[model samples]
Target: MSTAAIDVRGLRKSFKDVAVLGGVDLRVESGSVFALLGSNGAGKTTLVRILSTLLRADAGTATVAGRDVDRDASGVRAAISLTGQFAAVDGRLSGRENLVLIARLRHLRSPGAVADELLERFSLTEAGSRRADTYSGGMRRRLDIAMSLIGDPRVVFLDEPTTGLDPEARQEVWRAITRLAADGTTVLLTTQYLEEAEHLADRIAILHEGRILVEGTLADLRSLLPPAHTEYVVRQPSLEEVFLALTQKDTAS
Candidate 1:
């Protein structure tokens, strides 16, 4: 049986009468990739924030890595890392410097060795000595994620980690994400790119109107659609096509 790295029950959050997360419930199994799918303002980031201990929930409970997010906030923080939409790298510092800085702040011994290890792990060793400003979007994002792993946090929350990057750069980030999962790190990724969820997630949950409309493995979710028959050519629709169809059906009903 797989243990849940992150769990939530009846989570609710609101701002001035606006419900951002209205009774959200979710679970992410340890060492698996769980993707959260939603459009803009669907409260994916809000949920990630709540789970990561960055923002408090108005109601309900969440536990990360066996620690209660509210009652054991520090413990939750210690067991998880968050990579937001933007790459949080300083242009003035070299890639190695950034990693070393984070490792040092985390109070880990041999910060230089820690930085060097991550640099090689993320395939940034060749660029480690270069200033972050010189690195491409993908390289910078990889460095940011590598820095996040200085303490080997069990759960990682990535909120649109590949946004604004070109296709090639996106692939680079995708490889990094794959490596994270291969190393047995639980990832809860929020992405608007349906193809991204299709490629990386072990299970996916669709968030609509601040609630989970559906949750299942890709094949399981695909079962929600009726089988198609073609007379001339049999074509398989992509995840984007299926997602749009479902969401439109939901909205139209």
Candidate 2:
């Protein structure tokens, strides 16, 4: 198997007269969390769709989880799962039921066992039996994520999973992503939330105009910007300053 979790070279995509992605290239290390950050309409969603095998690039060579995405499309599908901006659970079914259905859809050998494990893994055990329609957005998203893991995929693609969520719900989703990474799952995350990327990404790549503008560890990225741009004023510092200090400390330590 290839060592890189995701590999893309000269990836390009176009729709009608406009180019959505232009010669984009990315390499994500195995078992690490990589975040793609860009503003609205920056081709983040287009890139995610291509990597997850939901869409084909107009021109590029890409491989995901050791399989050539274009030639080995089935292999890519088998090795990865995708969670979009919206939850994908059946509202009429309870959370547990939704998970079970997903397991079955994936043709897992033991759907019940997979559902049970996912429920526990996602901390939805107590709420597993509640109808998905009755659950909070966070709970629904948890179930959506849990369902994605039904086949125990090696790579997961989350495309703005916390978008449009309340603060508390967004935090819950963040925790879920943290736990998934802790368990050594390779994650390719695309989000417009700068703080979220700073908090969870092992490495971050900033995409603009469908191309990478900067890519590195958080500290390395900060270095690209002006110094004192991230001032560390402990007492009476603005929240932004405090955030910078804390993030720098966390990165440094």
Report the C-alpha displacement of residue 253, candidate 2, in angstroms.
Answer: 45
TM-scores, all models, native as reference: 0.91, 0.89
Model 2, 64-161: lDDT tens digits are 99899899999999999999999988999988899889878777798888888988998898988888899999889988988887777999999999
- Per residue, candidate 1 scores C-alpha lDDT tens digits across 150-183 of 8999999999999999999999999999999999
Residue 62's lDDT in candidate 2:
94
Candidate 1 matches the true fold with a TM-score of: 0.91
Best by lDDT: 1
Off by over 4 Å in 2: 229-253
